[model samples]
Target: MAGMDEAVAELAAEHGDLDALLAGLADDRWLLPTPAEGWDIRDQVSHLADTNDICVDTITGGPRPLNEEALKFPTPEAFTQSGVDKGRAMTPAAVLDWWRTSAARNRDVLLQKDARDRVPWGLGMSAKMMATARMMETWAHAGDVRGALGMEPSATPRLRGIAFLTLRAVPYALSYAKVEQPAGTLRADLTYNGETWPIGPDDADNVITGDALEFCRLGIRRASRAQTSTLKAQGALAEAALDNLRAFL
Candidate 1:
């Protein structure tokens, strides 16, 4: 498991990477459509900025919890749209400034908490876990911005955290999808930079073997089983997990 400091550092690195990407783009390019339907580069950054505030609010016990605020909107889509709408109203520079400000505050707040402390994230998770989730989200959104710019996304060592989160959150993913649990245990054996990162028991009969980047994509619902050429899942639970698992709420 990653310590709180290490996780927060990774989160900071992810943020820095995204910030560099956004910094180079021309203002007009902010309107380019990303792979995510109906979302442009600006919308993506806006959503991140809004979520950063919600994260801080959730941890500080501000006026409302993230889940509670979501309830005020008619549907989850509406709640998400609300954030995008906020971004649309700002200039690209303003949106970037907002993201940087909130991200800094979020990191500062996270650093003040203990690693074992459970925060009010989706399903509630340890501070380390929340940091990892934030890193994963930043990386995933960065991929969106890259795709919009016609850039090919690559894997980094940081993907180790995301892959671990994917495997660790398998049960939550299955439960959220209301899929019946399989009898066999599922294992993930992913490779990145010639390194094999394994998660699960040594004797597990079910296994998912693939590029760590693709596995992260699968876990984030960015790639379906059919979309990945390198990933293979053996046994029932592994197959179901490959198709239905989601690492984000």
Candidate 2:
């Protein structure tokens, strides 16, 4: 069984990787725009740190709203926009330092509790669910950082496991994309650790096959569907699925 310790460790390792990457970036590069709409690198890092604070608050307390209105804004986009606007005034070094400190605090909080503790998220989830969501967010934003800096991201089995779990939330993604698949099974052949984990047996006539990372990337729309060499999909469900891809619930 996956324990809290394992999740915490994975979170910490990914946080460390983020820290190292941010630390190496030049100050000017921090202002570079990323694929995430209006966010620059500095804004992205600060947003991540801020998200950690929000997560810590949720885990330690009862329930909290994950959206900006609940956070006193009209939308998450507004909140992130505000963060970016504020972050633009700070130096890149300051942003990276803040992220490091905030991530450490968040890690401490998660490490102190069991994985099953209840925590409130925008979509109604427990602490474990929130943690998994954060893991996915980290990976996605990290991909943004890597892409902006022309850096290649290294994949780990631990990260892949998290991705696998997050990908299971495809129905949520489908809802967000406003795309639905026909009643049928879709087989996903995922390769990791010299083995394969078949993710689905949906009754749809579609199948999506690829390396774990590539599949995760495509499912999240982080990597263009055309860029994936390992993916093979058949039937109308495959194309429809690609059209409505989303990484978050």
Give the best candidate by TM-score.
Answer: 1
- Put down candidate 2 lDDT per residue, 112-213, tens digits, no spaces: 766776665666665555666677778778878887788765577755655555456666766776676555556666787687767666564677666877
lDDT of 1 by residue, 154-236 (tens): 57899999988889898888898999879898789999888898888889999999899889998888888889999998999
Candidate 1's clash total is: 0
Worst 10 residues of 2 by lDDT: 61-70
Deviation in angstroms for 176 in model 2?
1.2
For candidate 2, the TM-score is 0.83
Runs with alpha carbons beyond 4 Å of true place in candidate 2? 62-71, 184-187, 200-207, 234-240
Q: What would you estimate as the lDDT of candidate 1?
A: 0.89
Give Cα-based local distance difference scores for all models.
0.89, 0.70
Q: Can you give the lDDT of residue 65 in candidate 1?
A: 67
Count clashing residue pairs per candidate.
Answer: 0, 6
